[model samples]
Target: MRFQWLLIIPFFCLLTACSSSQVHWRDISSNAVQASAAEEPLSLCRELYKDEAQIYQCEVEMSALLRARQQCEKDTDPSYCVLMAEYTWRHYKDHVLEDSPDIKQAGNYPVMCGYKENQITPCSLTK
Candidate 1:
């Protein structure tokens, strides 16, 4: 009985550790752009303009996109994760920020992916 209990304790500890380390979508995306100075970083600007309806729509779309990406990755397809992430970022840039020309233009300008102060239009330009 004592031995069985000891075995269960290790299993439970392992389960807790695994759950604690499970990275979420927000964390993954934040990590992806950890050093980016891109306009509307982490989709934060949406909150500033969201009316109730707009807020709901944004919430649903963003949540679905993140969940889909996370689920796809969990299914062992990292390509799907990458695709969904890019899709989500573009959606925000095109639809949500479209009304704000300034934001749109900022997004159009190039920004660094993993470094601060490297976000300049010419820096992002590709020949």
Candidate 2:
């Protein structure tokens, strides 16, 4: 009986050690904001695989990205279209930042994805 108890204790300890260690998204985002408030550098370790979309600005950007990707899904090669659209968006964001540093935007909506326009001009040259 004592031997069985010893075996179970070690087995439980091993199970606990092997548990998944996924970080909470809120922890990442909340910490970034908190760090900013404290005038501290972000405490997150990217090595832990934090989701970029968790950041407030990133969350905003993701809305546009997801919208663009969803619209692109109608294309014959949806996945490819989405990939290209994302690439274009990143470049477009960089372009806008270079041209108008004051513009706070989450990339222009993908016109190539058949999106006519967002009321928010974002970084598009049309504005």
Candidate 3:
């Protein structure tokens, strides 16, 4: 009986350790989806702003906004990313209106800005 208990204890410990090391499928899938979505807004911004300087700025801003959004999602604090997304969206909108009035008139700014619900969603993943 003593030997059996010893074996069971080790087995239970091993099981716990193994389970802890296992990756959660839901987490993996969610990460993939989020990563894909994050790429979309950045790509759209890149394509929309042909100017090298403008594209660089857009990329930097988009990256920062996406990172903030991801952190917000993880922390359950929507303020940071939400504000960043809104600000980024507005900044791009103003930039387009100022530089390319035709694009703004055609309602292309939103499409080019690539955000939804004031959040940076992956434009590529979105249809």
Candidate 4:
């Protein structure tokens, strides 16, 4: 009985060790922001990942956000457009930082998706 108890304890310990070790998004974003310079736009996302694919993704996302910011300046509803752009930036920032399990779910609002001309589209459901 004592030997069986010892084996069970080890098994539980091993299971605990194998559990997920994902870092929280806020901490990762905070660290990345601190590592970057104020003058550089891409630098804000550079520390989000180490692999080439992920780095490229960060660059792409940052570029799109920058474009959106520029467009917002010319938008009829500049304040609303700019606010949505900033929100989108934060959304993708969290996406790059979390690196956790899949966040998408059926019927869920598409938050990672982008807007168009200061308006969020796809209001109607699709198959």
List the global CA lDDT of all models: 0.42, 0.46, 0.46, 0.48
**Tens-digit per-residue lDDT, 31-98, candidate 3:** 43454466365465544456766555555445444444554453223554345444555566467455
TM-score of 1: 0.27
Clashing residue pairs in candidate 2 are none
Q: Which residue pairs overlap in candidate 4's backbone?
A: none
Stretches of candidate 4 exceeding 4 Å from the true structure: 1-37, 79-127
Highest-scoring model, lDDT = 4
Candidate 1 lDDT over 20-119, as tens digits, reads 5322334345433332344533354254324554443443334433434433443333454445445545565577664522323433422212122233
- What TM-score goes with each of the models? 0.27, 0.38, 0.33, 0.34
lDDT tens readout by residue for model 4, 1-127: 7789988999999898655343333334444334334577566555666666555555554454444444555555555654565565557556754562222321122332124544444323211
Better of 2 and 3 by TM-score: 2
Model 3 Cα shift for residue 84 (angstroms): 7.3
Question: Between prediction 2 and prediction 4, which has the larger TM-score?
Answer: 2
lDDT score at residue 118, model 1, on the 0-100 scale: 39
Q: After superposition, how far is residue 51 of candidate 4 from its true place, in Å?
A: 2.2
Best by TM-score: 2
RMSD of each: 14.4, 13.0, 17.3, 11.2
Q: Which 10 consecutive positions of candidate 2 have the poorest summed lDDT? A: 118-127
